[model samples]
Target: MGKWTNLIKQTTDSDPISGAVNTPIQLSSTFSQADFDTYGHFDYSRSGNPTRESGERTLASLEGGKYGYLFSTGMAAISSVLFIFSSGDHLVVSKQVYGGTFRILHDVLPRFGITYDLVDFSNIEEIKKAIKPNTKALYIETPANPTLNITDISAVVALAKEQGLLTIADNTFMTPLTQRPLELGVDIVVHSATKFLAGHSDILAGVAVTNDDELAKRIYFIQNAVGATLGVTDTWLLLRGLKTLGVRYKRSSESAQTIAEHLQADKRVVQVLYPGLSSHKGYDIHQRQASSGGAVLSFDVGSLENARKVVEHLEIPIFSVSLGAVESIISYPPKMSHAELNSEELLEVGITPGLLRLSVGLEDVEDLIDDLDQALSYID
Candidate 1:
């Protein structure tokens, strides 16, 4: 059998007699085996579970990887990958990334003597300039958070290989459906299943898919050692979320595109930042790398005061922190997602108080626009 098929088959979960796939959650903390091996190698839930294995295996196929590992959250996957590098090793990352990741790079990892350089990945030269002799990895997010900037994964991967550095892509925003970074040459692909993969704000999980068996084993070691494996209930929740991902993307992406166009036309808005925009800086590159424009978009409303006004006044769309849910929601990254950042730090990544990010849902386009139109008046 092909490697992909084999991985799928081995990792798949099924009812012993029923033959039902995507088997029910296995909550047992320990499994019994014969010959005093009561807890077979897979004895504990933290080391592995059927539900989690199925989810990881499914993601492995979707991302075109030989193996997949599920984590307690997306950050866990990223943190673990970064762990491979020792103290004093340098890492280069994009300037505009998910708030939580930014915090980890800027605030936490440095404590362990792991220094990182935040650069404008949109410019290959800038990234090249930032790469130090001690650089161990190039961590980036395409269609970056809040700003939606795109990075050329193939080019970056080639660059990393030439430098003998590892490459990791945060594939959460694109999901495997839109962009398979691994296929484009990324060594590792990370996802915050909490968003697109889960398609609901119900579960918090993360996963890393890789083609390298040794690397996978190393990551597995850390995952098991760290004991951040996904819980049974959350794994089931993620499984349920995956069932409708295609349908969810279909409706939500359309709504997001229409809203982005409408926002571009509105005089009150300074600019619209969606990959769907023809004039967007990375729109072309994004199309080449991603399957769709994605369901999330961000825009500027002139000033922080105006931004606050629109978010606080939205009537139909719910204002919340997360981006990919069944209900339309808006987020103020500087306040909601990046509240941890200091004033200067937030501004460094272009996350100004006036910037408003939107996670479009399956709602009707007219209502979303109407809600925004009415909310615009509240800005003044």
Candidate 2:
């Protein structure tokens, strides 16, 4: 079946009892055991729930993986994955990773005796230089948060394989619709399903998928042990949201390309960072790996003052933190998404004070453009 067809069909599961089109949410915390010796498929909600399991299986099928796990939030999924490694194991991480992931690596993981080296993933040689003998995995976020930097997934995976290290990728920005990193040889693929997969900003969720049986077992163990699994209600909502992902992503991406071009041509904009723009450093590579430029773009307006002026004056996109919604959102990295990083650390990753990340939505392209024009007029 085609991807779009599979998207809708895979997410739609009929209720066995009522034959309802939507997957039924099983809210029971515990199920009756037929016998003490033999438990049913799901004995406890924390270990597994019908709704969450259905969603997880669907996600695995979509990402072309053998196993899938869902969590209460994106961070929980990521943190659970990190728990797979033993104490003293090291990792090679993308420098432009999301703030929460960075916090995990910088603040949380170190206390567990896990060390990581931040490297510019665009430069494969830098990644090689950063890898130590203890490095067990390579972590990356292609079209990374805020900056939208692209990393060659296949290239990184190949390098990791040569060194006998696992390759983990955060596929939140591109999602499976645009780029399936697992298909590109990534060991595991993770997503903040709260964004594109859910399509609406109404839920907080995370997903992880893997093809390796052993890795899947480890992740499931961590998920069951940690008990941060997604609630049945949120799982049902996420499934409903997945049905419309194709349409939502297509419309948003088309609008994002138009907006990126508009921002690129504007004199008030210092630089536009979007893979859709050919002028972008990683445009060619991105085209090779992904289907679209995605629905997010970032631009620099010269200084923090200019950024604030444009953000405050913007009447269309709301000034907010999260992205991938029916409504457009504009966020300042220095204060919002990447706020955990200090000034020097942010600049080192090219997250300047003037930079503003915009998540394009379902609004009329012309109307969004007009709104942006009016906002930029206040910049100068």
CA RMSD, predictions in order: 2.9, 0.7
- Model 1 residue 67 lDDT? 93
Question: Backbone clashes per model, in order?
Answer: 0, 0
List, residue by residue over 64-150, the lDDT tens digit for candidate 2: 999999999999999999999989899999999999999999999999899999999999999999999899999989999989999
lDDT of 2 at 188: 92
Distance (Å) between predicted and true CA of 325, model 2?
0.7
lDDT per residue, candidate 1, 1-380, as tens digits?
64334434544467787787766787898877767635465677888887778788887887899999999988898888777777899999998888888778888889999999999888888889999999999998988888888888888988899889889999887777778898888989998888877877888899999999888998999898998888888888887777677778878988889999998998888889999889899988888888789899999998888987897789777788777888888988888888877899888887766899999888888989998999997766
Question: Which regions of candidate 1 fall more than 4 Å away from where they truly are?
Answer: 1-13, 37-41
Model 2 residue pairs with clashes: none
Q: Best by TM-score, which number?
A: 2
In order, the Cα lDDT scores of the candidates are: 0.84, 0.95
